[model samples]
Structure formats: C-alpha cells, structure tokens
Target: MIYDLLIVGGGVNGCAIARDAAGRGLRVLLVEQTDLAAATSSASTKLIHGGLRYLEQYEFRLVHEALAERELLLAAAPHIIRPLQFILPHEPSVRPAWLVRLGLYLYDHLARRKRIPGSRAVTLAGSAFGAPLAGAYRLGFSYYDCRVDDTRLVVLEAIDARERGAELRIGAKLVGARRDGDVWRASISGADGRIESVGARALVNASGPWVQETLTQRLDLRSTKHVRLVKGSHIVTRRLYAGDHAYLLQRPDKRIVFAIPFETDFTLIGTTDVPFSGAPGPVAIDAEETDYLLDSIRHFFRVEIGRGDVVWSYSGLRPLFDDGALKASVVTRDYAFDLARAEGAPALSVFGGKITTARRLAEHALETLAPFFPRLGPAWTAQATLPGGDLGPGGFDAFLAEVTRAKPFLPPSLARRLAGAYGTRLWRFLEQARSMDDLGEDHGCGLTEAELAFLRAEEWARSAEDVLWRRSKLGLRLDGAQQARLGRCF
Candidate 1:
C-alpha cells in the first residue's frame, strides 16, 4: 500500500505535518532517526514569542505570524504553553529607552493579542522583578510571550499524529529514497541494525539541521537552496531570581540574551549565535560559550554566575536559510520549501523554521502539497487541541485540582507535575496506582517505575536520556548516582 505522505525527521515540523496530514484523512508515515525532538526542537530556549529580536531586522511578517500562532498555541495547549511576562531592562548603552518602548508597542500590537496582555513601562527599583538586578538598571519595559515544554510539545504532536492514524517510527533513520514510477521507495535503518523499505506517493524533509544533508546525500537530489547551521546553547543554573517573570537582557554586541525561569528551582540562561560547520549531532556547550553565557548573566543581574555554578548545559543547531548574512543571528528564521517532482513522485524539503511558526508551517506545507493529493482534507489543526491537552473550560489549575481531588492519595507536588506533563492523560497510569508504593520504585526526582514504563510503552522512550531529558526534565533534579541507576533500568 502506498501512503499519501512519508515524512523524514520527528522534530516539531515533521510531527506537526504528520499530525495535520493524518487529520486530513491521508495515510501518513513519519520516520525519525532518534527519539522525537532528540535534536534542535527539544534544545530550544522554550519560548513561543514572535521573535521580538527579529523585529530589529524588519521581519514584521514573521513576527506577526508567530504572534498569531503564539495565541493559538496558548489556547490549544495551556498545560505546556502558557503566557510568560518578559522584562527588558533599560540599557542606554545598547539602545535608548524610547526605542525599547517603541519595539514593545510593535510587539503588543503586531497581531491582535487575545489572552496575552499588552506591553507596558515599569520601574525595576523596589520591585520584585528588580530585586535580583543591580540598582543601576531601574527602568525597563515589560511584555508577554510564552514558555513551552519543548520536548513535550514535539512528543504531543507525534502522539496526536499516531492517534489520528499516522504511523510513527522512532529510531528509524532514513538511509535513502528513490522515485519508483508513481511511488517513492525509501529505505530506513532501525536501531537494531535492521533496514526496512516503505513506499509513499509524496515525501517531506523536515529534518531540521539535517535538511541539506538529507537532500544532497541521502536522496541524491540537487537543490540550490542550502541551510546554514547556527548553534544556540543554553545553561541551566539554580534559580537566579524570584517570581515567574523572565528577563531579556541586551548585550554590548547588540544581541539579546534571555534569562528565563526554568524548572521550579532553576533559571535558564542562554543562547549564543555562533556559526557552525560540522556534523549536527549531539552538540555540547564549549568553555567559550559557557563563559559568554555566564558573562551575559553577570552583566545584568547582581548575582555573580561562573562556570562552576552551571548545573546542566545543552546546545542545538538551527538550520537557517543561507542568505549571505554575515552574522548567524541575522539569518532569517523564516521557513522555505523546495518542491521537486520526478516520475510522478513529489519531494518537499523544508528549511529554517522556529517552534513558534511550526504549526502554520505545517498548514502551509499541506497547502503546497494539496495539488499532489486531491482528496486531502482542509486545514483543521488551528482550533484543535493536541494530545492530552483537553482540560475543558476550567483551565490547567482547575484540572490539577480535579486530579488531586479524585486521587487523594497523590502528593500535591507529584499530582501537579503529572497533571502538567500528561494533562488529561495522567489517568492512564494514575488510575491504576493507589499509593506511592504502587508507583513501583522511586528513581529519585519523583520519577517512578510506573512513569518510566508508561514512557517506554506509550511514548516510545527508549533510553535514559529520552526519559530524563526529553520526556521530562528529571535529569536536573536527579544526582549522578540516581541517573546511572535510572539508566540501568533501561
């Protein structure tokens, strides 16, 4: 049987496209080389903003579209994607206060904000937001963006796709594909050294950093458009400040650094825009990148952060469209698609997209490939809720309350964590367990044997990293011994 679509990569773009296509009544198959979001998607700064910094580059359309999608995402998945307030401390040396206000105004009104509030001016002195900051930085502007559990977002899309009848094959690497008359036969190698062949009428390449390599080497297809890999690394440390609000600091180099509230106990600081040229696999934060991030944090906050203060660090490569930009930060974050058809089989390659616009990108991708499959349904993902996102009209807090009330045996913190991570789907495991002992062996950090088993059985989590880092951020809370113990379980 020939599938209507076969997607490469299991990042946000690929999973989102698969979910959309399957909902459109198409036979879809998604193949990923590793676990879902094992690369760039999971390693994001985890914000769903309109790329406020891009506005400086005059990327109005991109900002507007992203803001619109931000609203939609907040509504669709409240548990994972929620509104986050960003405080931009005034730095006269970087830009005047008025210029900052003007940018905030544009951001607020760029696309009609629904639930998110507009921007406003505020004083940092004597305020909770400024307690962690130096007295020198008193005045600043505040705006709203969003914080998301990036890995969960990717996994949710894949789960939704599978629920909608799309076949999801994780740990399957696409080795090669060639057009065979009206159908394309693709070869994929699994983790166990087994290769399998599948056929599809249309193919999609949403391999993130691997987009160009997949096109030129895997498929042996020639395309003039190439992707530039830009590495963005983040460092997680103990909570630097109080309150749920985040900070957007301006560097002397004109680049922006975000110090956001990460887990309940950590502050996430990141993102350097350095050009990279090498294999886009398992990128680690170098000493220079670490120093740069630490310096950026030290420059803004009164707290002194050093390399030793770093708890955990991660890096991801962004596959930006190579448009001759001298700086990696200036390269377009917008996505571009190259469509080629030969022997009646079509292949569409995607390049340079952020998590904010991935949903719209998938919609547009389907629209681009609509002509190839006439029976495909219309766009429907905008108003739809992702897997486990159905909290009804009561919202996340009310849902958590309901879960706790129903399962009085659950601890408040554990119940809250489970509700936020799984939302309505928490019942799949919780309904069976009566007490903490029923959870079967605490792996430390609130991760239980039951949860790990659920991840392996339901979410396709295959390794310790997949469970600890991608499935949930239990890695940050667990010690080295605990992590090794968890690893032994798998």
Candidate 2:
C-alpha cells in the first residue's frame, strides 16, 4: 500500500510531521536509521526554551513563536515537559544590568505565557538561589523556561503517530529514493542488511544535521544551500548547586553556557560553538571543548569544576540556517524547507529547526504540501496530546500519585522517574508486576530486567545503547561491570 507521506528521519521533525500528518487523516510511514532520537534530537540541551539570548540578535518573531509553543508543549505533555527557572547572574562587564532587564522584559511579553512565571530580580546576598554564586556577583535575574526529556518527547510523538495510523520502522536507513510518475519510490536498508522498498505519494527529509547528505546522496535532489553544521557539546558532572534552579553563565568571550540541574544528583554543563566538518553520527567532545566548558562553569560559580569531575560527556551538531554569519552562536536557529517537485513527484527537505518549534514546523510543512493533496483533512494537531500525555485535569503529580498507589512496592524515586518518562502509560508495565520480584533484577538505577524487556518490546529498543543512552540515562548510574552485564543481556 502506498502511504500519503513518507518521513525519512525519526528525530523531532520527522516524528512531529508523522504525528501531525497522521492526525490529519493521512496514511504516514516513518523510517529511522537508528533508534528513535538516537542522534541530534536526544543530544539537545534538553530545554523547551524560547532562547532568551536570541533577543540580542533581534530574532523577536522566532522567540515569540517559540515562547508561545513552550506553554503549549507544557500543557500537552506536563509529565515530560515542565517549567524550569534559570538564574542569570548579573555581569556588568559582559552585559549591562539594565540591558539584561530589558531583554528579560521582552522575553516575558513576547509570547502568551499563562502557565510559566514571569521574570524577576533577586539579590545575591539574601536570596536562596544565590548561595552558590561568587560573592562578587551581587544581583541576579530569574526567568522561566521548560525542561524536557528530549528523547522521550520524540518517542511519544512516534507512538502517537502510530496510534493515529502511521507506520514507524526503527533501525531502517533510507538508501535511495527516486520519482516514478506520480509517486516516489524509496528503498530502506535495515541494520541486518535487509532491504525493503516502499512507495509514497510524497517524501519528507527531516534528517537534522544529515539533511544535506540525504538530499545530495540518497534522494539525488538539488536545492540552494542551507544548513550550517555547528558542533555543541555537553558534560555531566555531580550536582553543583543546592536548588532546582539552573544557571546561565556568561563566558569571558561573550558566550553563554548552561549549568543545569540534571537527573537527581548531577549537573549538566554545556556547550561550545565550534565549526564541524566531521560526520554527525560519530561526533564526540574533544579535550579542548571539555576544558572550555569546565572553565566557563568555574568562572561564575563558587564551586570549582574540572575534567575530573565530569562523569559523562556528549556532543551533537546543530543544523543552523546559513545566513552569512561568521560566528556559530550568531547563526539564526530558524528553520526553512525546500519543497521541490519534478514531473509529478514532490520532495520536502527540512533544515535548521529546534525541538521547541517542531510542531509549528510540521504544521507549516503540511500546509505547504496541501496543494498536492487537495483532499487531505484539515490541521488537527495543535491541541492534540501526544501518546502517554493524557494526564486528564489534575496534572503530573496527580498521575504520579495514582501510579504509586497502583504499584506500592515500586521505589518512590523509580516510580517518579517512570511516571515522568512514560506518564500515564506506566500502567502497561506496572499492572503486570505484583511485587518487586516481578519487576526482575535491577540493572542499576531503577532499570530492571522487566523494564528493559518492556522497552525492547514496546519502544523498539534493539541494542543496549538504545536503552542506556537514549531511552534513559541509566548509563551514568551503572558502572562498567554493570554496563557489560546489561550489554550481554541485550
């Protein structure tokens, strides 16, 4: 059977498109080269933010749309997306206090922010949030952003797409595509060297950093240049501060680094702007990038962080639109699509989108393709809840309480983690297990044999990496021996 839409990537954009299109009554199919969000989507900064820093570049429209979407996402998936407070230390040398205040004001007002709190100023000497900051920093500003389980977000979308009649194939790599009259014929090769061909009415390339590679090499499509590959890396260390609040540290070179409260016991410090010519899949944090991130965190906080403190590190390439910008940080985070139709076949190539704006991008993409499918259903995903996001009216805490009551033997920490990751859908696994024994052997950090098996069966987890790195961050809690043991199990 020919699908109405065939999405080539299973990252945020592709998953979002699949969900939207499927919800619109179109038959959809999504193919992923690796596990869902095993690449750039899983390796993001993990913030559903409007990017307050973009205000300096006068990207008001982008910031406004992103900020508006932040609240929408939080409402749609409260279990996975929640509000986070960012503490920005006032650094007069880097940016004037008044200027920062102005930017914060603009950030708060640019969008329809009903659920997230507005910005506020705090005194470093008196406020609880400033206890870990350097004594020289007397004042700070706190604003709202949203934190997301980025990998779970993608998976939820894929699940929702499947529920809405979309076929999702993981570990399926798109090898070739060509137009044949009114349809597009595509071939996908699985990891085990199994190849399959499918036909679709339209094709979508949402390959993130590999957008260009997919266009030029796989589909053999031509379009004017877009997408500048910029490498951003993150390091995970032990918790730096004592609060739920995260810090936005300003570097001496006018760059900003995030020191976020990660998991329950760790802090995630990130991100350097460097040009990347290397392959996106094998991107790793270099020694210099690690040192640079460490130095930036050490500069503002009273706590001294070094390479020894880092437990885990990851790197991902950002697909920014090339707007003749020399600096990586200055490049616009906005996205653009190249829609080309040859003979009667249509191919849509998406480039330079962030996790925050994926829904809007998908909606616009469908609108752009509406001319081809004139009989397609109208847009319907704006207010739709993603799979496992049907938390009813009480919110995440209520759902967690319900899950805990259902599975009293589950540890509080483990229950909360599962509820956050799977939302109301935790019942599927918990309902079968009567006691801790039924949960199976612990694979470190609340990850159990039962949970791993559930992931493999339901979430398409084919390898250990899919469970440890993408489905969850259990790798940080497990030692080498434990990882090896789990690897063998997989």
TM-score per candidate: 0.98, 0.98
Instruction: Kindly provide the TM-score of model 1 when superposed on the true structure, using C-alpha atoms.
Output: 0.98
* Backbone collisions counted per model: 0, 0
List candidate 1 segments past 4 Å from native.
none
Candidate 2, after superposition: displacement of residue 243 in Å? Answer: 0.7
For model 2, the run of ten residues with the poorest summed lDDT: 126-135
Give the Cα lDDT of each candidate. Answer: 0.91, 0.89
What would the TM-score be for candidate 2 when compared with the true structure? 0.98
* Candidate 1 weakest ten by summed lDDT: 129-138
Q: Give the per-residue lDDT of model 2 (tens digit) for 263-292.
A: 999999887889987766758899999999
Cα lDDT tens digits, model 1, 1-490, are 6788999999999999999999999999899988899999998999998999898999999999999999999988898988899999989989998888888889989898889999898888888878888757789888999999999999999999999999998988899999898888999898787988889999999999999889988888988798999999999999998899999999999999999998888999989988999987878889999999999988888997788889999999989988888989899999899998855799999988999999999999999999988888999999999878899899998999999888888778888889989989888888878788988898996788888889999899999999989999989889899999888988
